[model samples]
Target: MDTARENRTWGALSDLPGHPMMWVLILTETVTFGLLFAIFAITGVVHSDVFSAGRAQLDPVLGGVNTLVLITSGWLAALAVEARVIGRRTIARLLLAGAAALGCVFTAIKVVEYATKVSVGIGLETDTFFTLYFLATGFHLLHVILGVIIIAAVAMYDSLDNLKTGTAFWHMVDLVWVVMYPLIYLVG
Candidate 1:
């Protein structure tokens, strides 16, 4: 009876899951990003002049557009997860594709922005502010790239169950951008 009960419990836990591993992964990622943000905050406070000057060089309009793109992608991803939960596999795939495409758009824009900055002689070596700006944004861009990959993986999966795991990771990526957008674009 005890063996049967144990088997039942294991089955219930594993079978009733939607990306059980994603929560732990997301938690670790959040802590890493949180530390990066804290470092930036401390540096900004202590070196306001450098940060302010570096920020002045940034094109707020471009940043604003990127922010919009990320937010929209996040919305789409959330919808995709909902669709999956409801067993609408086609809609979920479409939404996941849309989210992935938006991520590509974001990366393209960032490339252009970075090229423009480099052409104008503004780079990581320019100043303390530029250094921090590039480091933070570059790290975030890496996350975006990873998100694109994950979303693409979800798009390729034939089963909703498989796609659900990728969606969870994508959601965490979206959450990070929501925090980053306001912090990097508006507050400075």
Candidate 2:
């Protein structure tokens, strides 16, 4: 109600672990990815055969490896938050670096996968399945790139708030893949 109360109320939001802005962004990203997943599911249901063949063309082993890598990156990002909290700025920076490196590795693998698709003459208009695959994963890949940039900034700036915000973004990226791996690669 009063000014102090309002400030306190806003500050209370900060006490919930990460920055509130980061949480808001995470919610936005989640909704966007959720809609994409829904679209994928509906499209797959309509063209079941094409979707099945598309999933088969994808290498589940590579998807699994990337899943492992991203999860580890998310863990490292969490550690970065802990390290920053305890005044271990250097360690936090190093951990952020590790996380960003893992994200880049994931991106590289995606690039290779895209190349494989290209070589096989699979373009955006190749079919409904390929179109959805590229749209979903390619959008996710952009998020990965943005997450890496956030990691770099947090590592250099080195604050509890920065670490929390950056890692929040990184974790969202990882979460998207967790759904995407099964939805686009393993399932029909």
Candidate 3:
């Protein structure tokens, strides 16, 4: 590849945070979720009553707690990246572990919330609101699970770039939840 042409083609990657290739994954996932969010907003507007009733069924307080958990986790992940960059490998690993633990906590809370909904006979088939509610949240929950795994793996592997990449994914998970929580649980 010609050097200048190659730089022209791949130059934007140089400015992205974490491993350059990881940004590709990030962009793809973000666009996917963005579409889901758009669809959700449009559908909610179309069926305002259904969405409103579904929102009433949710516990905003619990969603708030999960928001706090993920935010804290993302903070720890950022700290871990900084630590790794500074050659504090042990501290970095510990911070990554902590971040992953918070991710697990988020997962547990979400599972409990789902269980509560199920026990009350609320589920995917209940209505349009419940259906989108389950699908969107469920998909995001799966990403959270994967993020926890990635964070844990990066902690074990112990490389600065790997840590950055893993935590970048975790942060995306956090951002998605930050957006999704209000839209699904509190918004009209």
Candidate with maximal TM-score: 3
Which digits, one per residue and each the tens of the lDDT, describe model 2 over residues 19-40?
Answer: 7778778889899999999999
**Predicted candidate 3 versus true structure: per-residue lDDT over 9-64, tens digit per residue:** 65788677778788898989999999999999999999999888888999999999
For each predicted model, how many residue pairs clash, with residues at least 3 apart or on different chains?
A: 0, 0, 0
Q: How accurate is candidate 1 locally (lDDT)?
A: 0.80
Each candidate: what lDDT?
0.80, 0.89, 0.92
Would you list the clashing residue pairs of candidate 3?
none
Kindly list the per-residue Cα lDDT of model 1 for residues 21-97, writing each as its tens digit. 66667778899889978888888899988878877778888988988898899889878878888888899889989
Per-candidate TM-score against the hidden true structure: 0.85, 0.93, 0.94
Residue pairs in candidate 1 whose N, alpha carbon or C atoms collide under 3 angstroms:
none
Candidate 3 matches the true fold with a TM-score of 0.94
Quality of model 3 by C-alpha lDDT: 0.92
